[model samples]
Target chain A: MTVSLNDLVFVAMALVIVVAATGVVMLKNIVHSALSLILAFVGVAGIYFQLSAGFIGLVQIMVYAGAISVLIIFAIMLVMDKSVEKTNLFSPNIIRLLAGMGLTFLLFVTLGVSIWFTKFPVVPAEGPVDAVGMLANLFMGDYVIAFETAAILLLVAVIGAIILAKGAEDKQ
Target chain B: MEHLFINIADAFTGWLMNLGLSPWWADLALLVVQWICIVTIVTANITVLIWLERKVSGFFQERLGPNRLGPFGCFQTIADAIKLLTKEDIIPSAADKLVFRTAPIFFIIVSVMLYVVLPMGDGMQIVDLDVGLFFFISVGSLSTICLLMAGWGSNNKWSLIGAMRAVAQMISYEVPLALSLIGVVMIAGSLRLSNIVAAQGNIWFIVLQPIAFITYFIAATAELNRGPFDMPEAEQELTGGAYTEYTGMRWALFFLAEYTNLVAVSALMATVFLGGWQGPWLPSWLWIIVKTYVIMMVFFWLKWTFPRIRMDQLMSFSWKFLIPVSLANIFLTGAGIHFFKWMGW
Candidate 1:
């Protein structure tokens, strides 16, 4: 009869995420599927907020929910309509379905075991005074290399996308 | 983040405890008040910005805009609201109705959400996450999905081109926008907007990072798709662009959303780089209002002054000029900071 706020947020987020993912999978129109994927990503971001990962939650909403979804939709727009909705897959293979089911079962089992065995600890929020400086130090000191790598990765992506889009324009 | 909320909540609870009440009631009261404040500010801004846009545009063109209805056409927006509410909502014959109906609302809401993290003054922000600047840029990017929805949902080729243009413009400009801010973030040594403002307490970012500031200003203007960068809605090229099929009230929603977003981005720029509400004599909120309106006016001025840039040139400017300069600025900031620290400044 009594529902905790966090529990309610978690359940609602999960339901929305599941519905969105299923919508993404089942939509016949590629564009509609891309839009559904954005909704699903947003749902995941909601769950991230509920899990108390403030930085991760915003990044989820921004990078994946915002940027990548747009990229996917833009890519969908570039391709000519083949009406793949009806013939996207040639006859659903039973083996593929079984493999998918098996993978899902394994994932659930592993997740359940982790949930049962692990004693999760909530990390206390560092006082606001130390927090900003601490984050800056983390990124600048220990994770400097990773940050640099991410910048490089973004550079590579920009180059590749420009090449692809430019080639298409030239062809046209 | 938990402690941050807890402290704010505890301050209220501490007051309640003075009155000999439990902390739970104070926490509940604080939540209700903050949520209400957030909704009020966002809705109020959207409404006022819509009216302001029409008045500004009319003044720029030598005509009184919507002046027949209310004092100085103030309530023109109100009449427009009534018109929209009473109009029959039409779905295109082959349009995806669900997405079409939902897209505008999402666009408005997402744009509104970006303001939550934007600080109007020192310590006057909703959330003070360490990644506030990054968070703001990221949230703004979500509008592209809404654009794509509006485009595809219309089932029109023009709409689709407009949406595609938006996607290209936003993504292309995002690099320089984020990169320019890295210089500010480097100089400030923090990504928190409040911290950035406080860092500029003595000297603003514009003084130390002028190149980055200009780069950021241009990128922000482009990001909002204003004036010369307003290729997505360039009427001549794309026939009203992505919202080509939209008519009546649906058209108005897009118009209102665009102006509101312009205000949001301008307010954000003022906060992050313009020393946000920090000024002589004036109160913080008033300073914010003055700076925001000034930026909005500049937007209107640019809209009237310059012709829209060709799409290729706009994209080329970002990739060729802005991106390279921003990259250099980032390095300069890093070296500058290191040199200052080494010199014991």
Candidate 2:
């Protein structure tokens, strides 16, 4: 079959995502790693766009790439050790490198076995999805109980954070 | 009356079709031409706005701003453009060259992408997506990356500090900005910007949801990094902020992006709250322009009059005060809508 524009775009987006994900893991500088992670996030969002899910694509960029990436960058900046400058990114120690490689290889094998061996059936797309409205309905109407539970969970997390940050005030 | 731009676009596209090009090719050509026009308009507006901002600031300080260049100093930006174009582009030795070179371009791209959903006039938007409002807000949030990139790439303490503060301030303020819009969204019952404007055919949402308008305006000001919330580029403290290491056209791109974002935010406010392009006598396009300019002037007024707030104050103001107020405004809007429906009015 001849490749269509959609097929071309999908392939391009998938390739970009793979490369960006590789950059995220391989980059030595934490800041550069975070930037590469964002690129991967955007690429995933592009894949969503290719699926015609514009709302989800936008939200993916908004939450994952925009807000969370900024948070990651902030953490990197705050925790960075500026005094340490190394020419080689990887450690020269043999045992540590082997251990890391072994762990990664294990992960790859597990994922490969799980995904490649599964008998998944493909579902062809019927028509365009009203992502925003469908999502809003799912959260607000159909699964509102789950939605409110998630909100409460977030509130609990916020309180926990406040307590952690203000621990000194409690003692004083 | 029909949209002026639509008519012109139709004429141009029709002429292209007469050249015997394929349908998709002609459409692609139209898209390219429209993009060129949009970029030109954005650049032109940024130039005029930079001059206006200077003049407004000058007037605030009781001085003549750039009077020597041309009538009302209109040509001053043109003069500045030439100088900037010719100026040396410097990259610090310690900088990450790739990110440093790419940051400003990314920043400008994010700002320009914001204009895609903007309804410049009645039936004169680029693309009226179903999730237009969401698209605008999401794309607007991505500008933080540009700041983070510029700051990290520069390898300068001040730039890093500025970027850190800028991102923190922007992200915190973004919650309230988007929340405040929910009140308007609830009232409009649609996420489309054009529909929101149309919902205000009878009256503007500013009058109905005054608290949301106030909350949105304050949050938006902080989001745009102007006035009391202008902590990111507090030149006294952080020098030039994220673009500190940048010079010439690179810095110019960042500068242009700021004004472009300003125009975008005003256009959004106009569409959401001020009954965009909806008036009696003048054309709809002129009405939208007038409303946007007024909102922009209000932004300038706030910028000039207010003192720069402390970082703690900015953060607290967003979380402690604005967030709760916007949430309450949403509840109030929801209840009011429900009450109206109950009464069958």
Candidate 3:
């Protein structure tokens, strides 16, 4: 057996994602945590790239790392009180840590049970990577209804955002 | 003949094999060499772009631009680079050192990595991924996080405000930008840059979809944070905005990233709308350069012509006008394509 460059890259990317994700939760500063979250998001995008899913990888970067991270940072900046800056971030107490451990255990058990109960879907073996075409076909053809529903959901969100902005304007 | 660059590269890699290097080593070397070339080209182009923008701005204001250093101030940027190199990097006492140091590096990396999907000419891309346009756009989206990092890391209230405004502006304009390109993607039926270019052989996408072109240009300008939409760097209002605290070479990297992004966007406009590298007589790469410069000039003109709009007006215009217009353009394109097909043309 021989190791290939692809395997090496996949390992590196996976490690980066895991480490960065850990940093996200462990960091004291919210801003640093958000930045760590961006790194984690980028690593996940890299993993998608390694899977030859270029379109999904790019969308991941755009949505999660780009828009979501920026939104999170903006929200943090806007809502954070000044006094919070001076104080050290509160570490979780033992009871809270135990609670978190319990939740993680529950999630793991749920995932394992589901995996054991359900058979995996058969994935097609057509190996050529026409990711863009395949994704576009899926989106516009078989998943057209789901796609349109997503668009409507976004439209509703936009309208809701506008109303919220207008209400703030009236208050001013 | 069309595969001139590809042939030269194949010959070089083959030579590396003859020199007793393993295939993997040669391939790795080739990859490194290609990345270095790309980075060098981007850096060199940024220098030229900075000088050109200055000259263009000067011309707009009816004055002589930088005409002293090396033939119409061609070397002005190089001199500025050296000056920046010698300057001391100052981190504010209150700044988060980790984020502050990393922000500009991330910004520059994102700026340069945009070159990966760009097709220099036919058979001339570094890596011609199938989703080239999507990759281009998604990479462009990541720059907002860089701005956010820069803004927050500076630890200044004004910087945070600028960063917040930037995030809002970028994310808002992003919708219109993506929507504006849908008509082109629909007509071309491919997301790859080379395929998109090939599809425009008979007629450029700009001619076929003028509405989409207009919307794309406007949204891209906003995305670049150039003048008229430059709330992030509105000096009079925000006092240099998110970059207020950065000094020395660190500051210069951010500036470099800005111009690099400018060039990248202009190149995208050429590839998607104007026929990319598709002119007769001149080599294809040269044609791309000419087209890209032409588009860049228009961007510069827009920068000098329009005054910055109010922040609220900017966001409103993007959401209300540009997004709807782009959506309509897509609808019209689909209908028009069907009509043409029905007419047997």
Candidate 4:
């Protein structure tokens, strides 16, 4: 029944995640929303760090908070009109709102039930796990095919993007 | 000499424990003390570095640097710091108030966060995370957001353009930077900064992975936004770029953060390639400082010697040249590792 420092930190990080996520959804300024998304990403990374998944946490920060957030902001800057006071608009239709609320409620219920039913594994107290090494082994040994497939998929996407960009230049 | 700082830290922690503080509270106190020491060292070091940079640049240009304030103008930066602190803090009327206010604060915080993973000496890191190098890189990447925030929040064309250029340049160079380090990581078989340094006990990675060293240097230069690759904040073109809307202590914070990043990257370079903290005559900490300063001198030399490159040229240099070169270095490193293993050496 005693609240420890770890629990306090977890609560703080969870609050950050929830508040930032809310900001992402409710903010009228698209840029502010994007910034909120970054905060939420960082909070999630903090949770990963708290769970001792340092590799995953660092990857989360690097890929999500760092690169992806920048990309999102860049896109926002490219498309946004300077004259607009509020960029992000919500629909006023009651039917759409009702539908959205229903869907969100359903999702929450499903996720809550799954979490309640799931049995979590207890981590051993021996020492810190070599998460990075185990991940490397998983990728290279057991999941090599899946890993290589993801790599090839990324390469193909890059090539397709380049081709699309090059075609637009040719037309210009 | 090697354990001097460690012993002092232990003694301080013991004293706190003797005062009836719990182990956790005592450890937290020690961490706070380390944080204060790092901040003080960074500030003091930056004071000297700024003065040295001015003197070196003046030497390069065959002109006398500031020599009026103190002996050889050694106190010039302190004077400037006071002036900056005393100057009026101006926030643009049209600016995004929250983002503008938080940008420099976040930038400096991100810059200082990089020190956590830096192996200052033998067993001298703060936390010594297993993925130390990755932690440095990921935390370093967060600075791009600070710049973006500065640019977007300023609501100025020049600031926006400069920030865009900076983000593009940083993103492009980051790939090569990470790739170039893979050679060292492959050789060391670990991403921990201390472990990488330990692997270099016999020979420096610079001697082994020459291509990686070269590519890493080039990429790091671009990443740090130094001269020849400083597309962001191209003063003549963008007029201070992301810093255009900032004034007084706010602008000073950005300047301090940039110099802080310069030192951190230089120190990392020393650790990765130049055999960190390894020398005969001096203590490990002193050795790291010497190597970091030597690398920083090269940075200063390059900055003063070369004209700023065109933005297009900078992008192409990183994407077309450095990336390929770094990728080839990774290949070569893998081949060499396998070759060494096959030879049963």
All candidates: CA RMSD (Å): 4.9, 2.1, 2.9, 1.8
Clashing pairs for predicted structure model 3, backbone only: none
Task: Estimate, for each residue in B150-244, the C-alpha lDDT of model 2 and write its tens digit.
Answer: 98889898898888898999999999999999999999989988889899999999999999999999999998989878888999988978878
Q: Point out where model 3 deviates above 4 Å.
A: A83-93, A109-128, A157-172, B1-4, B22-24
- Chain A only: give the TM-score of model 4: 0.86
Error of 2 at B262 (Å): 0.4
Per-residue CA lDDT of model 1 for B109-211, tens digit only, reads 7777777777765456667766788778888888888887888788788888888888889888988988998888877777788888888889878789999
Error of 4 at B134 (Å): 0.7
Model 4 regions lying over 4 Å from their true place: A82-84, A121-128, A165-172
Clash totals for all candidate models? 0, 0, 0, 0
Best by DockQ: 4
Candidate 4 residue lDDT tens string, B148-216: 899989989999898888888888888998999999999999988989999999999999999988888
DockQ for the candidates, in order: 0.53, 0.72, 0.72, 0.76
Q: Output the better candidate (2/4) by DockQ.
A: 4
The window of 10 residues in a row where model 2 chain A has the poorest summed lDDT is: A79-88
**Which of 1 and 2 is ahead in lDDT?**
2
lDDT of 3 by residue, B1-345 (tens): 566777777888999999999998888888788888888888888888889999999999998889999999999999999999999989999897888899899999998888888888877788877888888888998889888888888989889889888989999999999999999998998888889999999999999989988999999989999999999989999998889999999999999899889989989899999989798888788888899999999999999888899999999999889989999998999999999999998
lDDT tens readout by residue for model 4, A1-172: 9998879999999999999999988988888888899999999999998888899999999989888646655666666666534776677899998999899999999999999999999876743567778898999999999999999999999989888878645554
lDDT of 2 at A149: 98
Better of 1 and 4 by lDDT: 4
- Chain B TM-score for candidate 4: 0.99
**How accurate locally, in lDDT, is each candidate?**
0.78, 0.88, 0.87, 0.90
